[model samples]
Target: MKSGVLKKSGTNKKKAIECLQDTTKNTIVFKIKSNYFNENYIPSSNTRATTNFANLARGENRQENLRNTIQMINNRFNSLAKWDNPNDDRYSVELEIISVEIDIDGSGTTFPSIEVLKTHINDHKTGKRIEGIVGNNFSSYVRDYDFSVLLSEHNKGKENYSIPDNFGELHGNIFKCFVKSEAYKKNFTKAPVICLSVSSNKIYNRTGNHHPVLGFEYLSSKSSLTEEYFEKMGLKVRYFIPPNSVAPFAFYFSGDLLADYTNLELISTISTMETFQKIYRPEIYNANAVAGQCYNPSLKNQDHSLTKISYDREERTGLGIEQGKFAEQHFITPNKNFLEQWSANFTM
Candidate 1:
């Protein structure tokens, strides 16, 4: 059994390397910018910050928001997602920004736009890029998660619960443009995973459940509408609330990539989520109130002007309840079955 596991690992490693090589060949590599502003972290003054969907919206400071969020995510992975091997090594994922050429007729649409950015694994630490780490990308809007409109449509009833017709078309085009890119051809022997993070409070179905469920279940159901469109194009979908995360993130891939995750990898992912919660979003973890502080962009001497923001528990749906519930349901509760079968594989 040990030898068989080793052989399977070897095979997976080979496939991963091939995928990485293909990715490198196709991807438009840009040097990682040293500063936040250069990396599109700061938003322009004209950008509008609104509160219609504070939990769901990406806000006017979209780049800054992403910078802060990704920073927390990266830090979480680095700090908590470690492997207790001979070297006591740590694992991390790298995110790269890539632009896809697509024509948008911005006549008078108030909807958010989608951007193509890919997530890659750092090969040196992970050993193989494709096995534990795969090419995952996300489609996000320029200004918001577009939940205000989405929720309104969802309230129209189950028939309209799926992504809006126009929104679906836009995403379809984005995927079409992505597949045509040289990067897509080189990096992916199969379809890359697509992740979506959005607000879930109002979008969820609150009735007819044997047990209480988070709004994510409803949101995932809605996303299934889009998933079907993608599946017809040859992709598979998996949606989850990242452990300790308030926002909804959906992952789409070509095959059973998520199913192949080891128990340790899942634990590491959850550890990252918990770490993120402890720092950026403490309310969910039932921890001390933590606030995020940053230099005010408006000030010329930005370093001197610090702006602190606290996440309000009242404003969010789950607060301290959902994350732990998710962790219990997905990880701890299922561990009994996992342990019964793969007890020896839990070395990490």
Candidate 2:
């Protein structure tokens, strides 16, 4: 089915335009109130701890921690030394953060909402905003997730049990709201991208003997309903786990941005089996891990292959953290086949 905003009323157009104008100014980072992360809230015993920067919300320094994490992502992507696309003259990619707040009522219902709060362009050596589209505005949600059973189930295991039935519909509504706004049509007529960093403990690799492949859950399940819906709107989706990142992030984009190979290059450069092993359970990414095992979503009987690469000791040992860890990491080293496959699979 199709996704994104479908209705275009005069009032909606006016509001969207206003939102776009308000966000496009010189503002870089927008900070939310501290109360947004309530200390009183606690997760149930059954719920597993969230990975990556998502865990920052539980601590007292939620804002600072998340900001630091985002800054790292920004710095890594903007580094020209790390990304040199031989296909294009552009040597760098710039990204911005657009923080949005979504409110969940006491009954655990997520109010379909988003607000563009901050935008940060990466630091480039040229000291000028690199031409062309400067990547996406990192949109983040500003509410806790303990109360929602749907979120808990989808987020806290070796495999996602199920996604919210309306997950795709909500994203569709949000996309509609975003596109209707003036900023989207005027500046991002090509369609903007949304990058989300969240937990992926439940996503496992079926072919690697059930070894946890990063972001596998989102791609293989009904949880991908939102992504499928977005694809119908001519957008593309990609997911990856950064080195030492407990959770993986999803990127949705359109136009030339979708064709750009920078995101995957950066991710592969920074990530290693050891890093993933440390963040997730070691048993998953370890060298001795077996192959052919798979994870079956309780709701769906089908099985999804985790990775084409075997996770045997030889393969696992070959992936050393030091290989790609350098300030001036290798450029022109992205996996082209992987990129093409991902783009084809997610783009309708």
Candidate 3:
């Protein structure tokens, strides 16, 4: 779907987001707009994170998905740690999904919808390393509901749509409301920053950068709905393929993502995103080398050779969709009334 606002759907309910354009068309970042808000409200823990960073809300087969997702998380941790022998515990990286309660409904009713990652890392002698933490790809649920579902659905059927004059403003405002919600304020210390894989179909030319960060320019167009939506979320996008990594990752955040996160956190995300990238976008990450005259990439027209990693990534795509639909049905769809309350009442 187009970026500024999503395509419309079967339902014609004039709910919260439909009016978002009119109510908050010129809003900016929550941190920037708020006169008295803490930048680091919840300081980054020296150990595992609060799970507020990227959480999974409830689902229909909630217990089952939770169990499977946790297993996936543990597997990801093990694969990245190179725990070749699953039976052996000499070297292990573990993640436990602990329940967190929050009022997501906007109404007074609470949902045990949030889950935090409690980590336990072992290195032969080093028993306890990180305390607790954790991703978009790694999320138990789709955290960017507005960006992924709401806006995308809103713009679906339109063939010749003009991005609103205040596209950034409107989009950012919706996110701003989400960030400033009471549940968010209570659960998170700082504002949110997340990462997404660059589209495989979009051709991106590598830009000059001395560090691990490899800048990229869209070979097709300067801006995309994804780019603008993220900018409105208060971050600029840059691609980075860290030292000794297989592929480039697009991180969206304000200031510097590398600087903003701790070394362990960075390692965790690299393990999460790069591994999945290696699986899902194998043409790029798994490529022996970029083919053709230009050393650049067209991931769809890829050159790939699978590397050593267990677990069937191809099988998990369906699970990802199921998880998303579950989150949308349980978390986002039911919350429309709340979002409406949010949209009509929100201010710049």
Candidate 4:
């Protein structure tokens, strides 16, 4: 099986603690509950050519969201490839997606633990694999199990229901284990870039530019756990509103998220993430006075800022309890059978 569980119970604890130290070679580890590895000691083998990074949001209308995300990707590619689109074909390059459910062990009633989506990107004319981007669409069985279940039990019945000081450490380490596997080494040529929504807490502003980047002038008082978690992962975060995009997106990467990738490769991720944001939070992306405004010759404002406001949050905490309950009912609970099967079958 792809799931790699160490057989020796005692060594598991040692291995878990060892992961807490500072990384030696582009690897970062952080403190988490020791018991986290007691049962799930080893990480998944990830033998399949896939990545756990997913930009999708939780809730109903998920399939529709996926379809829309694909359309956006094609549209964005065509826009960016004007030279390649003189005749206005379907796209300058096409990204087709295929997905399969990881039944964690195949015992789930019908719903799998999670689904993995892989995109095949090719040049429209040559039909050659030119863009090196694929593997998206992972569900939150890992999130549900790690955060909602394990973390809950770890801090259960505490006074004020206190959580550990290392709130995001466990998930981050598990994620590290996932990416560093031999399968990942075998599959890809570079480190992964994960794209997701910008913080609802901050108003993003962008300077008008043909090539884009974040204008992070308006600093916030505190960092979100999401920001801290990625920091612990040794990843740098940048926010950008892609050309013709409605809102900004938070991109986490070990290297330059922009420079490390080809234009079409980069656009593939941006399009998927931006479409995902628009679908899940219409109030944030669509139901507003503006989508993405391109200001005429951006000039320094009163605060000496070069950018203008793009989005601000009302009350949507991306990690709120309501979101958890929804995913648990729709995705996790139905896939419990698979988790059990996976647990029993796991071994070194």
Candidate number achieving the greatest TM-score relative to the actual structure: 4
lDDT of 2 by residue, 1-348 (tens): 111111222232112222321222211111111111122323221111232222333455555544443444344443323444333332333222122222211122122133321222332444655323322322212111211333454567646465555344333443444454544444442345544432233353332111122322224343554456566434676554433343334556665532453444333223322232322233333223232223222212123223211223443223222221210122102322432333233311
Against the correct fold, how does model 3 do in TM-score? 0.53
**Candidate 2, clashing residue pairs?**
5-176, 16-181, 16-182, 17-182, 157-202, 158-202, 206-294, 209-293
lDDT of 1: 0.34
In model 2, state the lDDT of residue 185: 46
lDDT of each candidate versus the true structure: 0.34, 0.32, 0.43, 0.43
lDDT of 4 by residue, 18-129 (tens): 1221232232222111111111122233211122212222235434444455555566666656565676443533332322122222232122222233344556676676
Return the number of clashes found in candidate 2: 8
lDDT of 3 by residue, 1-348 (tens): 111111122233221121112333432111111111012122111111212222121224334433444444445554444434455333434443333223332233332332333344545545546632232332334344444445555578988654544443533545555555543454344445455666654555544453533222223345667777667656677766555554566766665665665544454555445554564467776677632212344556445775433234443444444444555675557665654455556674
User: How displaced is residue 186 in candidate 2, in Å?
Assistant: 4.2
- Determine which window of 10 residues in candidate 2 has minimal summed lDDT: 28-37
Please give, for residues 192-232, the per-residue lDDT of candidate 1 as tens digits: 55443322222433222211111122223444444555664
Indicate the TM-score of model 1: 0.40
Q: How does each model score on TM-score? A: 0.40, 0.37, 0.53, 0.55
- Best of the two (1, 3) by TM-score: 3
**Which pairs of residues collide in model 4?**
none
TM-score attained by model 4: 0.55
lDDT of 2 at 21: 14
